[model samples]
Target: MSLFVTYVLVLGRSLESSRGLLELLTPALELEVDDSPLSLSLHAAAIQLWCLVNSRSFSSSDKILTEAYSRLRTAIQDPLQRGCESTVLAALLLQRYERFSAVWNQHEQCHVHRNGALALLRQQKLDGINSKHRGYLISQLFHSEVNICISKKISFQASEITWLRDQDLSILPSNPSTALDIIGASIASHQHKFTLLSAEEFITASKPDLSQWYQDLQDTEDQLNNWPSTVPRHWLPQTLQSGKHFDQSIITYAGYSDIYPNIQIASIWNLWRTYCLLLLQIKLALLGLFPNLDEPTGTTQDPRIPAFKVKSVQLAQVLVDSICQSVSFHLGNYIEPTSLSELMIPTILCTSYHDMDPSHISYTLYQKSSLFMSRDDHRRHVIVQGPWHMMGTLSHVLSILADSESHIPVHALREGQMNWVRTQFLRVLRLLRIDLEDLSATNQDHCQANPGDLHALNTVNSEIIAKRLMAALAG
Candidate 1:
């Protein structure tokens, strides 16, 4: 009945299943358990959060979580505790709790913990932390913070942390070079200080300048372009085809049975492409060569804009295809339940960016993702971090597609084809417990039909509907 007892039970179950995670925790658990009550509480809370997230037992895990937070708060009150090992561990535990719980209201608390962790890192300095447990916690906190900042579309203010930038790539077993590259790109994307351009300048390119902003962009672009050469041949996506139809096959990677490396490589590949696509868009926009999504009054006056749009579409297609391949490959492997959850958020983003057309592979891939999300337990895997929800991202993407349908003629499908896609997403939203009213009520005219009309009951089944929708779109 007590929080400790419940946590112990959950930890026991976790140890039986996840040897990798348990291995990561063993040093921390061993070093902390006998040190103090606070250390033990922090370790227990971190384990509980991880188990609850993978188990999808949000409701039952609240008691243990509450106790964890209460103890963390008490531990942080002493001024001398600022750079202590236990204090940093507690902050890291709270950060994990915020990530796993995925509650909107708790996001600010997540930020609080993030800031707390950064401050601790700044105070102690990375070299000062003698314990391997403390070092691992620091690395994780930095990784998680960078990811959080990227998802939120904000600047990572702690980009000045020397240790993170100075980390040796050769020392790391998995090679986090790609992750670091993305973090740099993310930080660069938000550098609006030197230029008069707003933070949203990347999207609109309202003002053009050649300052530190341009330099940062160029540096990131060079890094991305040069990345493939640095990758070991074994780590690279193997060529599946060699000749005329090479692009499609080149996008596919050789499958791996090892889930961790497979995920790491696939995620790095996808994120790199996504950022490259984004950078291209920004560059095209700056050069006044980006096509407007709205109805074209005349045949594209500038040939460059249309060409760039074609390139953009190609990049988006590659992103979607890569995600599908990653998912399919991972699903084929024997994986733990939560091994795929971390990939879901970025997968949703990449899929949404894809401009759907009958000929494009994205149409089929999107359908597969929809069906995946419709599974009974799949919705729990939808990660919630600031301004990003799986359903919300999906809805936003659908809205864009629906809007674009009115401007660019979609001759691939019969009448009401787009409506069916909308209905499919409506079903997904309902299943995920997201309110359709929130999306549709704001702009009733934004969608072709009311959410009320798009019910799951009218469809034969999700898979059949998906198949029919794909068929209809193809037609």
Candidate 2:
């Protein structure tokens, strides 16, 4: 009894402090308690508590996690004990990563543990774990299952995703804004991987059949332009402009500002927008990779879900909506005609410095844009490019997620009621691009003369506007 308590406390503390120890203990606990039902329950609970620590690096910690995970993966003589262990491990695995379907598939040969795990989670009447903890466990499980089903070509049940979004897992206080931030980060991490594939797709498309891929991309861009003025959800604005020259007004904090009033900043939408773009990029890349690739893309490997049906069309729409809504724009008007160093990187846009809006647009744009941009000068140039460019590089991941057929029915990514999301991204991009181009030309023409002249003109305009406003106020 004392040994168990010591193990619990020391292991708990170790898990909390060093992920390496947690990793070692995970499998160790599973092995030691495999025969005892009570021990299994306690170990599972401990695993959950351990997961809620500060160090949660998924890829880096996979070694230890997998080592521990192996112990709970066997076909045990006791079905009930095996099932309970499976449930706990499944929840842990899902919580750590969304690609559990693939992992599960790789180990499906051991059906006893898998079945046991599924049964354990499916049973709501299990004792020991409280409702709140159950919800958290289920939430993690759902997220993993849904995303895994999404990444693999599998069928999903509608109840899953709905359960996740609708389920009240409020064990802890979660600020709406902070929750959104976490969601954005999670989506972005996945989207970043997809973007990498998207870039590769671009390269592949550009290599030989540039016309086809480029044309397709152009068509998609055009479709994005036709979106309506209103955004999908939680998006600040649909359109933005970046002048040819660098900016200066907001540069004091926003990003770069070589010239004044050139950069137009606005929020795009939600995390979904990022996901959608990644999906599109992946689809395009896959199509580009094997133009005649069958619907299943035999080369794409088995579906993530055991034998679930996939939904490509709906998934595509979801991906598109996600990317379009999440995007924000930074427009440049009369930026500095000087060297690039004169321009500022968009670092001041973080949550810490979003209040530093020169145009007084509000906090929406400030927060959305600042999520990805950092003040680190060393990486300023690298981060300045738009989300599309970044997401484009990770096309594969987005493609995997966007490809509904790849998704297996997990609790999170279910085929919910279809909701229409209208957009005009392509049209707005084209319009803004043209407008900025003209402005750039005008700025260049103006630049033929002394830059002092342009500064003088701006000063005079400022004085006139200020005096007019002052007079009106005085009246």
Candidate 3:
């Protein structure tokens, strides 16, 4: 896939819906196979597989997918023959396929493709492609790596990209996707470097000066606190209560959820809130990690820990409520599986940040976070772009949620995540009178959404879900 291919998705065609995407590709297929047709085929196959998985019926032994993969693999063997940009696109498509298809199988080549893409991008950057076009792929590769770092809980520099290091933060406008990515970068960096602030590491021979670690953490925290000031006031999210007019209901699970003109803006705001909560979680974990330390005297109880706890609870309450409030909007009439996937990452993480209290006492961050939503948020709908495994809204919401649950439950989620999933997520189900020990996320192996007949399935399910969801909210 050349830069033109990516432009087809981002700038050229209007992908207001999946049908628009299909229309975009119809013409793409007729073009001369000059710029890596295998790459386009790989992407097309991934989309077809996504449609199949969503359709709920399929039988080809994945031969089409397999052939596309083979062609992409052979093409990449001498990447320069077709160009590394095209290979990176194919690799990214493969990365995406692995994510949503995790329920069927975990492809080991997932990282092989990602690393290959990264290596090529790094080589290009080091050699200086000098073309602004390559910058888009670099930005995407940068975003992919950022997501991997945060999702995998690795340090910020864990996958250092030199371009990212040298990129000036101020040039990116304050509140859009770029700024949000920068925010994630900062938090991921802090999460990785947070080790210095740990009391357990204070005495370790390899540890840096303990005070400097605290200073850096404080600086990051301050930066985060001040980030919102940079955003234009009109672009910030507006709070809306349920009894108020909305696409779904008059009230929210926690009494209110925030609303935005569109999903991207919503995600941008939520990302900030979620990242802040995550930073607090990191601090809280450390405080609890060293609770019994009498030897550390003044060292163990940082002055900020108490404040962090209070702020965490307040943020959790507001965040969860607002997310639940907005869940229905995100679930509304229709959405693309890919859009739903992107929107729900922050939604799921917001709940996870507020997670559970092992002592089993304080409050549930996922509270009434929608017994309806918890079920859908994890559905593994396949999209070969990023890690969005979850159910789709209407059927769209249900589809998106189903995919989220599918990963590994099919890829976006990993093991031990269910440690808390078993408790909090199940609690939501129990309230709905459903018997479940954990999120269906733990049931990827049992999922059977094979795609086909989406029109029929969604037509039936959307009406059913819309009615029941409204009743549930009203009750």
| Top candidate (lDDT) | 3
TM-score attained by model 1: 0.53
Error of 1 at 188 (Å): 4.1
Using all chains and alpha carbons, the TM-scores for the candidates as numbered come to 0.53, 0.30, 0.57
- lDDT tens readout by residue for model 3, 344-413: 4532222211123424222232232221123223221112211111111121222222322111121122
Q: Which structure is stronger by lDDT: 2 or 3? A: 3
Candidate 2: tens digits of C-alpha lDDT, residues 1-475: 2232333323212211121111233444545444443334334444432332222222443444454445445423335544443445443433323222222122222233323444565553334332223433443344334333333323334323333344444631232222332243234333333345437555455433544543444444443433323222322332222232222332121232211111111212322343344444444454444444333324453334312123444455545433332232221222222223323534323111222344544334533442323323212222232322222212222333334443312223423211111112112222112112222445535544543233322111222222221121110
Native RMSD of candidate 1 (Å)? 12.8
**Between which residue pairs do clashes occur in model 1?**
412-475
Ranking under TM-score, best-scoring first? 3, 1, 2
Greater-lDDT candidate between 1 and 2: 1
Ranking by lDDT: 3, 1, 2
List candidate 3 segments past 4 Å from native.
1-54, 57-61, 77-84, 103-109, 126-131, 160-175, 193-200, 203-208, 232-234, 247-251, 285-308, 333-475
| Candidate 2 error regions (>4 Å) | 1-63, 70-91, 94-117, 124-128, 149-154, 158-475
Steric clash count of candidate 3: 56
Prediction 1 global C-alpha lDDT: 0.40
Query: Candidate 1: where are CA atoms >4 Å away?
Result: 1-23, 34-59, 73-86, 103-109, 133-138, 156-174, 177-208, 211-216, 228-265, 289-309, 329-475
* Candidate 1: tens digits of C-alpha lDDT, residues 137-242: 5555555555444444346664444456566533222334434544443543443231223346544544323334455666677777777676544344421222
